[model samples]
Target: MPKGGKHVGKIASKGTSSLSIPGPPSSKPPDVTPSVASVLDELKSVIKQTQEEKEVGEQTLTGINKTHEKVKNEPRVSLYFKQKLQNQYVNALQAAKRELVLLEQCLKKVDEVKVEIGEVQARAAPPSTRNIDDYRSKMHSGLGTMRRGMLMTVLQQYAVEQQVWKGKPGESPPPLCGCVPADEKYRCKPADQVAARVRTEDGEEQWILAEVFSYNSHNHRYCVDDIDEEGHNEQRRYHVSKRRIVPLPRFKADPLTNPEALFRHRQLVLALYPQTTCFYRAIIDSPPKEVAGEYSVLFEDTSYPEGYSPALDVPQRYVLPMRETKKK
Candidate 1:
């Protein structure tokens, strides 16, 4: 061992660093030493093991990413709660009606109480100028009745719209496309366009515009869905059910804006209610690529005013419903 083995102290010397080549230990038994081929085989085995581990690591990362994506793109949970909310609303309506009935009894009681109190107060002290006047009370009393009537009238109008716009005319909006098609009918030209709105399962609402990119025999249908609350503003579903789903609104009696107007002039476009929002790589501030663990996404901006914003941010996913640039 001493004869063949090199000393570490001598190797550490800066002057001897270039000249040193440490040799194997000369042990007493030669049979215990591994052959050069065997040593090479061991190194190869370690290299192969490392490669296999690397492959497994990659596959694991891939699977985890896929699972995350599925969850990210899934439909919202709001739809499920909506029905229960409607049930509660019906219960509230019934309770309100009951309360209104009770209110009649209460009104009689209140009148009696007011009369008695007024008599006592009149006897106890002279009527003050600050006391609520009878006329003002009467006016305030009618407000609740007027509110109920207004609500009923609005509901009736919605019913009428539903009857008239039940999937009328035209096919559903087209699915998000990868590229602008060449066929004039399906191709989205500023000149040829129609906008519409619809209520979603959640009772929230959204507005959408359908402009054909080009005409084709097998043109894919646009996916749109929405909801509304208290008639305040629009709300919509990100993922529209795939089918020929149409909208409640129709082309205006007359164009709000001229044919050349992009989205601005059209009163509806100015009211741009995008029931759906598509996040393309080219457009939006936070595209999927920039957000590493992100993906290209489509979401419905249910709060669209009306036809305010066109479905401007179209999804750039797969080329859904492949069609030719120029139709045959």
Candidate 2:
């Protein structure tokens, strides 16, 4: 069975309940607060120990099966000896299976712990100063509301196509520009829409909308331009590793024809912030109930004391399924 498979539903339900609106901020500091790095170190240790135990258990089961097979095939072996060996194999195999089961549970717990850690970290970290300034500027200039309204209309019209872009459960979403051709020599081409991981001034990486500008074959990196820039002169560019780039989906999935394309309430996602092309981590407060309805999402924003942005309505084109965590 897949890791955490048994706990998937339970976890989702718990997440929904726990993510309530943020309460008023308290003046007192949290007592005995633990550093994120320290906590991560402990989780790392637990994961390592559990992985080792699981491997050993699997090897033991394999060895027992092989030994039993050999004993059964050996005609020269006496019946009494064969029976004794079979009894031992049965006991050993059962014990190994039990151990493997326990290890799987341990892994599931680890994943849950990781999610908790992420929540805490996101809440504690402050929003980017530059982004805040830009947002304030737009609002002051009376451009933010107008831009958001126009964007929402466009997104609503493309809702069906947006749904199809997301990946199925336990899978990575398709690239924004669609999958690269199997025979293609390069993963991306100039002007292709994609998401690139860009590091902010505070040393945190965020996935943002970008367009491929050029490829550096020597270093296997793509030079991409930020798509959110209002003017060509103000646009920023970065040379990112091929692995850090995800192509946008070129096709759409119609929820009318594909029920699976509809997102579930409380599902985690990457949503485009209002009046911006940047995507941020968010949770689906509610999925659209009608074809023309919008998704209600709560974005992770440290600007709020509760570490989450106020619930906002987003069009399907602005929301994508959360990316899968990469294995080490």
Candidate 3:
């Protein structure tokens, strides 16, 4: 009986030895490394410092200018003192100019850094998240809301001017070449992907994916090739008005930094029709809070008596700003 009890005890000891309680996972914080958030914080600090320096430099320049003016206009000032003050003024002016140049360069560097960060974020994002609308939002994210709105208004005005000029006889169309300074802000360049408004055989105008083949400088129009003509023996092409083309955005907008990128409720926009590659005029019923979120829109449809389709949820990539046109 004692031998049996010893065998049982040996089995119990073996079972106890086999049991284990894992020690709590290592509580050490992750190794410190440069991250996107850290870089953004550093950039913000740099911008703030540079802006402050710029204000100070401007103030100093203003003071110097005031003194220089006073010295030049004063008749009582002796020649010796005038000459000395003039030399000092010239030196100070040059120094101030140099400082301003440096500050401008610093601000440009900050912009470059922001662009790099955006590219990194875009590359890290999932493939499904990449799209033209997101790119457009990102490109304009730096602009203030009021500025963006004004830009849109200007574009709409240009569109109107083009339309009016096209109907005139023997008159030169306004230059849509966008060759001047800040040209890109006004016109789409060749080889750029654009959403071009096309009139179908049914006379319905729909926006479709097209590429700018070439610009007709004489007519102020673009020769665009339809992107959906892949299976056709001959490629479909159109000579589209500059006013009818909307360039696709080329970068992803950071939602946190650019809330203005989101469409406003009730704003007119172009949205891809479900189960179709064609884009159509739509009204924003509600905008998504995040860049990745979907937009609720009511697309224009002839079949509906109300002339608008039922509210549909469209992905951010499929929604874009409507081609602006002047109302008659």
Which candidate achieves the best lDDT against the true structure? 2
lDDT of 1 at 231: 26
Residues 1-328 of candidate 1 have per-residue lDDT tens digits of 0111110001111112322212223342343223333433443443344344434444544554554565566576355455544554555455444433432332233233333333333334322221223222333455543432333333222222221111223433222211222233333332222232334345533333333233333554343322211222332333322232222122111111111111111111112212221111111222222101111222224344541223343212211222112211
Candidate 2 Cα misplacement greater than 4 A, ranges: 1-186, 200-204, 216-220, 231-234, 303-306, 324-328
Question: By TM-score, who's the top model here?
Answer: 3
Per-residue CA lDDT of model 3 for 1-328, tens digit only, reads 0111100100011112421212112332353224534544554554455455545555655666676677777768788767766775676566556544544444434444444444455455544225433323433455343332332332222222221111133333233211011134466777676778777545656577677899877787889976543223455788887777776554323233343556678888877665444677889898754333457999877778888878988655556777666422
Q: Rank the candidates by TM-score, best first.
A: 3, 2, 1
**How big is the positional error of residue 196 in model 3, measured in Å on the Cα after superposition?**
1.0
Q: How high is the CA lDDT of each candidate model?
A: 0.28, 0.54, 0.53
| TM-score computed on alpha carbons, candidate 2 | 0.41
Assess every candidate by TM-score: 0.15, 0.41, 0.43
Candidate 2 local lDDT, residue 128 = 26
- Better lDDT candidate (1, 3): 3
What C-alpha root-mean-square deviation, in Å, does candidate 2 show against the real structure?
Answer: 20.0
Better of 1 and 3 by TM-score: 3
- TM-score of model 1 relative to the true fold? 0.15
